[model samples]
Structures are given as C-alpha cells and as structure tokens.
Target: MSQTPLLPSRREFIKQGAAAAATFMIVPRFVLGGKGYTAPSDQLVIAGVGVGGKGESDLASFAKTGKVRIGYLCDVDDRRAAKSRQAFPQAKYYKDWRQLLDKESKNFDAVSVATPDHNHAAVTLAAMQLGKHVYVQKPLTHDLYEARALTEAAKRYPVVTQMGNQGASGDGVRQLQEWYDANLIGKVHTVYCWTDRPVWPQGIPWPTGATSVPPELDWDLWLGTAPFRPYVDKLVPFNWRGWWEYGTGALGDMGCHLLEAPFRVLGLQYASTVQASVGSVYVDEFKRGYFPESCPPSSHVTLTFPATKKNKQEVTVHWMDGGIQPERPEELGPNELFGDGGNGILFVGKKGKMMASTYAANPRLLPLSHNQEVKVKPTLARVPGGAEGHYAQWVEACIAGHGNHTVSAPFETAGPLTEALLMANLAIRGYDLRRPKTTGPGFDYPGRGIELVWDPQQLRVTNFEEVNRFVKRDYRPGWQ
Candidate 1:
C-alpha cells in the first residue's frame, strides 16, 4: 500500500501560502478602481458590536452571504459571547465597542449593531461618522431624538444603512402593496395590530437587593447610556425588555414587524395625534399604580396619521399588546386562525379588508377565499430569498455603495417608523404622570384624560409638556 502524504504544519502552510500569494498577488477593487469604487462583486467586512443572542444570529446571517466577513466581535458579557467567539474564531474580540472601533476602524468596512435599544444610537452614529455602513437592530434607539439624529446622519455621511427589521424585505409586504395599489383594498382607513408579548416580567416593582455581578459580565458597560442600577439576577441575556431604561416594551419589540406593511402599503409618516389607555398593576395589596420604572403589563394606544403623498385622508392605527386583540372579524369560520393565533395585523378599508400575520407573513384577503379569486400584478422587485435574504441584501447594497442600491429598511424609512412608535409610548407613560393635589396628601394623575397632539416637524408633543422628557433623554456620564 502507498503511504499517504502528510499535511503541512500551521506555520509551514502559512509560509507556503504567503510565498505563493506573493508570486501573483491580486489587487483590491478599491486600489485598482480608485476612490469611492465599490461593486456587487466586492466583499464586505463587518464588525459586530453586540455578538450574542440576536446579535450573534445577525452576524451569522451576514456571513452566510458568502461575500462578507466577520472581522471583529464585541460584547459586554464574556459568557454571552462564548458561542460567537467559537464560531468566528478568526475574529478579534473586545469587551468594549469603543475600543474595538478606535483600534480596528480601518480594517472593517461596515458595522452591525445588535445591542440593546439604549446603545444603538451612539454606536451607529460613531460608525457613520467614520464613514462606515451600519445595520442596527429594531426600534433603532431608546428614544425619538436618537432616531432622528441617526436619520440625519445617514444624509450627512455617505454610508449605506439598514434597520434589523427583516420583514421589510419580505415578499408578503410587496404583495400587500400590490393589492392596495390595484385597489383590491381601497382607501384603508384603520389598522389593528396586536401581539402577545412581555414574555418577560412587567408591571412589577424593580427587584430589591443587589445581587453579586457575574465575573464574566461588565455591569457598567452593559448599562451604556441608561442610568446605572445595581445588578440583579436574571437581568442579562434576556428580561431587560421589561425595563424602561433598556427596552421599549412589546410595541418596540413587535411594532416594526407588524407596522411595516401598513407603512409601505399606505405611505404613512408621522402621527398627528396620539391617545392611550393601559392596564395597571398594584405595587402592594391596596392601590393600583403606573410603576413608571417598568412597562405596564398591557396597553392599547390610538394614533392618527395625517395625509401623506401616498396615502391621502387621515388614517387611524391601533396598537394593542399584552394579549389584547381587536374584536374578531365576522368574515369566515370560527376555527380559522385570526392573525396566526397569537400575533396579527388587520387592515380595514372602504371596499374590502385584508390581513397579515407577524413579519407581514401569511397575507390573506378577508373571507379567506378572496385570496385565490383576486389577481394583482406584482410591480415591485423582490429580494432574492424574501425575508431570509435581508442580511445578504444589505451586504450587496454596502458593496454597491450609498445611493447606488437601495436597502429594504434604510435609516431614512426606519427613523420615522421608530419615531411613531416612540410617540405612542409617550401616551402610555403619560398615563401615570402625577401632580401634588391642591389640598390632600395624595397626587393626581393629570395625564390620564388628555390626547397628546404631536408636532412631528418640531419633534415634540405640543399639548403635553411633561412627556417630552422621554423624547431626548440625557445620556449617562461619559457616553456623550
């Protein structure tokens, strides 16, 4: 039997590869094609700031494009980052995003920010300021002002940007758009969006006592722009969604997926007026309260959007969460699922009605059978793999450079959508505003009865001054 040849050692393989490459080195496109030259054929190098949970999955999706590389990984918790470190073994690791950016900015072409809502703006803005493309997670930022600032930055800096709402690139939304455009669902006046969320705890007082911080986690760094609080057990990895400082609750979590369809189909922009009502929780045995530190267990918010170029006539959008769903439609069989059971979106129009499930998936005309009867020409181009293609879409767009190709959910579009959601939150929070009573020892909930009129251009609530504080929250020390 012939003996098998031995493989080269790591050092020998590197040296041999280097020698072989030196003989016929290929120049990079930027070097050969000159400044501002990027094409679909080129590769995209990305630095992931929050590489765990959704962050880790986001990076994995990007790398799956086969035209991208994960060059750096950063996360506050070492334990949370263990899987990504093992997957992207060649990537440089860091506990601080600022340090990663400062040291390796020159080596990467784009940045993917899947951090909590509070950290999205600072990391994304810094990357854009460096002229790097960015893909940020949903809700975009912790507050409205940050969303607007990043929206403006996309214009100021020549960089391609996309929000992490993959549903925007789905074929379902396009079909909805086509149906609407074909007048199948004529002049939609109202939309109802509902979700079963807060899979984490909410409506409870902040946990008491300080738990010892995990050795693998950097508590302070995790806080980012949010105010510091003592570390508590089970707050990391998940459960932060119920806290006001770190998350935007169910609306922030599911709004993007459910709202994108209506926005695209009707061309909705900012809301003109917003009103809300919420379910309350009792801190003790006696009285009900707003536990402003935590998101209410459930809420129903109403928003009126003014006429835009694409959608004439005002539209009313209802946002429901915490298992509150709209009254069942009288269209068909009782056994048929309503909006994929737990989550759904229903659009009401003058001529007919249509609906879709979360991520704008499973679209159907009311009566169910109308779906097969209706016919509308598909006018929009589709992303190759639909929702699954979202990551690769951004990669190819970054390679195509700013303005050369359009992404599904660019910052320009995501900003206004995010602002509208945050606007609704103002009402939920305002429901708890207190004032010292004129005579007695107790406080009055003045914000309960009023409708907060919005001034989108000025970016403030014209009627309620108290809730404006949430629009542009102060950054923690040194974060600025």
Candidate 2:
C-alpha cells in the first residue's frame, strides 16, 4: 500500500492499445464453422455507405442483431453521418464510398448501401466485385440497366445480397401468398398499387439559384454518379427523391413497398408491355408547364406481365401515385378504408379480391370478414421477427456464404421487381417528351398516347425508341 508504481500516460496507453489492435488477427466466422455453423463470438463485419437517414436506421437495425459489428461508416454529408459515427465510435469513417470500398474491402464481410438511388448500383457493384456481400436500399438502382446488371451479377458473384425492401421479409406478403396458392384470390389477373407521396416537391421547375454548400457536406461526393450541379437548399437529407437525376420519383420511393405483395403473390416477373398517362401543371392560363427534369405531380402507369406457371393468365398491374388511388372495391362498407388510406395495394381476381397496406401489411380478402373464415396452411417459411428480421436474415445469410441460404429480396427477385417499377417510369417519362415545333413558340408532345412493348431479354421498349434512353442513363465519368 505504501509503494506506487509509475503508469503509462493516457496517450501512451492509447498508443499501446492501437498497436495491439493493429496486430490482432480476426478469423472469419465462416472459417471456424467450416460451412454451416457460426460461433456465438462470430460477428458479421459491416461497412455502411450513405450512413444517414434510412441508411442510418438500416445500420442500427443490423447492430441490434447483436451479431453485427459496424466496422466502417461512409457518407458524403458529415452532418448526416454524425449520429452513426457517435453510435459506432470505433468504426472507421470515410466521406466517399469508393474509398471505403476500395481500401476496406478486405476488412468487412458485407456492405450496406443506403445512398441516393443514383449511387446504389455503383457502390453495390464494387462491393460485389470485391467478393463482399451487399444490402442495398429499395428501388435497387436508379436506372433499369443498372438493375439488370446487378441481377446478372448476383448470378455470377459467389456473394450473398439483399435489397432493402424489408417488407419482402414480412408475414403479410406470405399470408397473401398462402391465400393465393389456396385459390382464395383465384388467379389474380389485375393488381393496383398506389401511394400519396412526393410530400416533397415534384412537377416543378428546379430551383433557379444555387446555395452555399453545407460545410459538413462534400457536394461532389454526394452527386456521385449523377451529373454535376450546384448545391441547392434542402436537397441533401431528403427532397432529392423528387428529382429525376437522383431519384425515380414516387414509384421509386414507394413502389417496392406497395407492389411487392402483388409481385410475390402472383409470381410476377418482367413486364411484356407498359403504358402511362401523367398529370400536368399549368404555368398560366395559356400553357401547360413542362418540367422534364421533375416528376409530374401524379401518374397512372400500367404494366402487363406474361403468364407464369403460378397463373396461366397474363397479369395486369396498375401503379398510381401522387394521391391517386384505384376505385374502391364494392365488397367493403362505404366507410371502410381503402388500402390503409393514403397508400395501399388491391388485387382483383376472377373469383374475389384481396388488398393490403404498404409493405403488404394487413392483407385481407375482399370482404374483410373472409380473413377469419379462410385458412390455408402456410406454404412459405416466415422470417423471424418479420420485417425487423430483414437485417438479421441478411447477416445470417452472409455468414453462411452465397447459395447456402435464401434471402427474401435478393437481387434476383429485387431486380425484376425494380425493373418493373423503372419500366413503368420509362412510360411516365416518355409521356413528357417534347419536340420543337416548326411553327411559332410552341412544342409538340410526340410521346403522348404510346404503348411501350418490352422485350425483357433485350432490356428495351421494342415499340418506342425514344423511351429507350430512359432504360439506361450515362453515368458521370469518374463515377462509372
């Protein structure tokens, strides 16, 4: 008690700890399991790109699994990354996703992409090429070409992948599937999905002036693969969804959630044809506003899919957005809610009707009471914890390695789903095509009243050549 020994200073202690960490060897859990098992100590190392907003929440859910370690966090906006950085203080941070993937590819087991729709493909493709598993947010990619590329890449890469449409793991869709398999909805040929989105701006002209870039943001990095543009107020955290350059508008925003149930229940794949009509804004008494860069306030798009084995008859799916909804079914009371109110999906079949809210939640037959009477044994396995389990499902799958287990929204499934949504977008975009008129100060809308015949194999609208440009967009040089 009388003798006290000299101790290293706090800085010295930190230096020693750093040295120890540098030398520590992390044996991957897969090595210990020898294929099918994972030790309790084994953790899935995750590197999150675009760690803000939804991305931030996605990482938190993964960490909640108790089997995941947030090893790296990357985002263009420092302000957006602040919370994640604080939560995972030990995680290395980067402002650019490319640097995170390029340098840390060997350090992490999987990558979670929560970036804007535009960068989703670029980041995910790089991670997959590095032999890392990936979890990308919904609407998978900004462009149809990227979606198809990822779909094909999943087949080639020996890595696990999941798209962030968590609803895919929810029991509601499975319940709908069970009922459909039991013929409760008898060969659903027509489906309607709608949402009241664009709570942000749309169908408006781009802001005329640029604002000083946020000091915490790397504006160039935020743009990623999209074209260069000056920073605009309120575009970073959100509001980007209304811009075509960075988002796919309302469909891209909520299509995955609302359309997933119908896609799964009907076993739908690529669409054979797509058609659309969009609402317009009037600039004045004499002219209708034309803002090709912004998504219209509302739109109605129809996609026809070829018959699958699950149903011999072809299927027609209609998508409505911007407060648009399908006609209410007659089976329900006039006072009853339609598609969980503002957002929902409805399936009309020859025998009966079925509907569900966003994320396919609260699935029910035409007559709500029928849900209590009809019981079909579950044909599909349910994800533990339902939607909340989506994160753990990917973590477990990544640990098991590719092909060892199935994920709910792998690129294979998500790609087709996303392609369908983006295909519908092609029609929406096509509707606004404008051409210079030979006469006075006016323009001609040549794309109006067109049916786009899709050839899934070729990834093109066989009937409409102009709309093909929307099928795939050119990326900014360095980003590509």
Candidate 3:
C-alpha cells in the first residue's frame, strides 16, 4: 500500500513555481546594501498554532527579532487568539490548525506549535510531514511514542526543529557543562530536580458536571486528539496541565526545564529503569481518594541511566514535585536559598555539589564562594542572547535551512530528554494502577512497589507490561 503524500515534493513544487520562485531568489537587501536594509521577502514567514499565553509570547519574541514575520495565527479559542490577532494584525487567522496548514503551508516557512501536551504530536507531525520547520513547546509531546516519533521525523523530514525548553540555550547549563568538564564536580553520579508545580488541581476527581461551552471557544477543536468529553470550566488556558488525558502532570510541566541541564552535562540518554512513589489525596478522615483520571498531588520518581562516556558509572536522576525538596547541601550557608525557593536542580558529585534554579539559571558551585573562586575557561559557544537568544537561534537556523545550523534543543536531544521525563511519568502512572479484586468490589493496586525495566528500542516497560499503555495513547477518530 502506498502512503498518501502530505505535500507535493519540494523539488516538483519549486520547479512548477519556477517563475514565482525566481522573484524571491534575488540577493538579500542587507548583502547588497548595509545594516537595517533587509528585504521584506527575506523575512522568515511563520504560522503560530495555539497563539495564546506562552504561544503569544513566543510569537511576539520571534517577531521582535525583525527577521521574522507572523504570517498566520491559529488557535481553537478566539478569546485566547484575540491578543495575538491584534498583535499580528496582518496575519491570517484560523481556528483549526489542519485547515491552516492545508491552505497556508506555502505561505509560511515554519510553524510554531504551543498547544496542550496531548495535541502537540498530531499538529507537529502534520507540520513536519508538510516539510515545515517547527518550534514545539517543551516536554515535546504528551506520550513517549510521540516524542520518539517526532525525534525520528526530524531526521526524515529535512527541516529545522526545536523544543521550547528555552533554557537549553541559556549560559547556566553551559557553565555547568564547563565546570563538569574541568572536574569542578568530580564525575556526577546523581542529580535531583524538584519543583513546586501543578499549582492547579490534581489527585482529585474530574469536575462533577459539564459547564456550557463558551461561545468563543470551540471545545471540539480544543479537545483535538484526546477522547471526547463535555467541556468543563477552567480547563482551558493553564489548568489542563493537571489532567492525564490533556497534560503530563508536574514532570511534563517542568521536567524539560529542570532535567535538560543534567541530561546535557552528564550525557544522559534513555533510562534503564524507573520507580516512583506518589502522594495521595484523602477524601475523608479515614478513606484515601482514588482519582485515576488525574495526576497525583505529589510524586518522587527515580530513574537510572546506563553508563555513558561522560560518566563511567550508572547515573541516578531524581525528580520531585508538589513542593518536595531534597536535603539542603551541607556546603551551603543555612540562610542561602535552595533552588530559587520553589524549584531547583542539584548535581551530586564525588568531590562537591552544584545547584541551579529553574531553567538552569543562577548556577552555583557548592559553598557559594567556589562559583566566584573557580575559573574554568569557557569552552561552549554562548548563544547570542542566552536564553532569550533561543528564539533568534531558531529563526536564523530556519533561514539557513536544515543541516546547515544547530539549535539548542533539537528533537534529537529533546526526544530522549522528554521520553526520560515521560518514562518517570510511566512509573508514576504505573504506581497508581488498580484492578478489581477477584472476589470483591474492592480494587488491588498491583503496580505499586515495582521498578519498571525499560526497553528503549521497544519503547515499553518490559518488566511491567500493564503499565505500557501510556507508551502510546490512542487519538480520537478523526485525529489519527
């Protein structure tokens, strides 16, 4: 069977539009003249999917670069898209991304996807299939399979791709890398990443009843690839991060930002095994609540990675959320802040320790003074504007085309990093697995107290088959 082509071959399309293409092939105005003389046609045309909140800010940042033009804006909710619409008044608008891509693929050179976790894969895959460079929000996709798929697709599609974990472009992570390379911290063997996330509700039952769908919101389109359900209040915008069908829990929300540092500095890849323990919610004085549809209130997950060239010993990475924190390093003053108070990443090495705040910002060697005392020559090339430079980096890379430039968190790196976080989620989800008891109405929690052995090649929990359902989720009928 032959697969239907998503878009006409690039070669054929260019050949068919030879006359029109020749007009755009002229030398850039900047090269012909001087600074501030770039041709309008030379600007990178972008289409933003989910242009609201963070998406709006992302698009705005790209436009601020003066080298990018927001050519299209798309979102399921008009209320959310309104600001971006006003901000980029010249851009065309669409509520459905599919329609936008189908009709405007030629009008835009790239697409920015900032949708909820579950819908990320479908939209990104479609965009890549059409040969559009993509900048997707962090935790790249909702499920393990999607992350892996997007990673592999980046190679096959011949397009520049970046995950929105902007910290990957920050200087702090590079400083950590340089320090580690210089043996400031001798052979890191353990890493702890913690956050106070899920500021929204989790570990609770879904809202009791559906609310009337808002006139400005298209609930069906908003649901996208997830299973259909009546619209509920407060699920849009941000609260959706706490739901399993829509979000990836706290890990999905913050792991990419917190975990990217260790993964990069330590040369970590997929985890060999993962185990987790999650906090439960109590519905009453004597009874604990069981909300299988929602994420836990808190979780502590430990993932073990195989030995890599950077670290000869197996590495253990710990993730905690919902306000849980690791022990304060003894080398620090008692009054010093630990991980910016609410979130942080810590690396424990044989010789010393180091920590940083969210987005790998404000990195410091243990004892504070070491950060100022130790001088290691900078080795990694710094991104122009550091974390903020992440946007321009993508823009320039897109202009350069695929295989010609490097991005901070390309899918090749993000896929495995995201999968590691999602794998921890698999353990978290598996820890809550319940089955009806053979002889009674009660349930048995069978997945608890087990270390899930992972087979990266197979993308499954080899030791716990039942928990593998999360590896690949089922999209709704039309979505697939």
By lDDT, the best candidate is 3
Q: Each model's TM-score, in the order given?
A: 0.91, 0.92, 0.93
Worst 10 residues of 1 by lDDT: 1-10
Model 1 lDDT per residue over 265-312, tens place: 899988999999988887679988657888989999999998767767
Arranged by lDDT, best first: 3, 2, 1
For candidate 3, give the lDDT of residue 355.
Answer: 95
Tens-digit per-residue lDDT, 59-87, candidate 3: 99999999899999999999999999999
Return the lDDT, model 2, position 11: 70
Candidate achieving higher lDDT, 2 or 3: 3
* Weakest 10 consecutive residues of candidate 3 by summed lDDT: 1-10
- CA lDDT, every prediction? 0.86, 0.87, 0.90
Candidate 2 residue pairs that clash: none
Runs in model 3 lying further than 4 Å from the true structure: 1-37, 439-441
Off by over 4 Å in 1: 1-27, 30-42, 283-286
TM-score of 2: 0.92
Query: Candidate 1, overall lDDT?
Result: 0.86
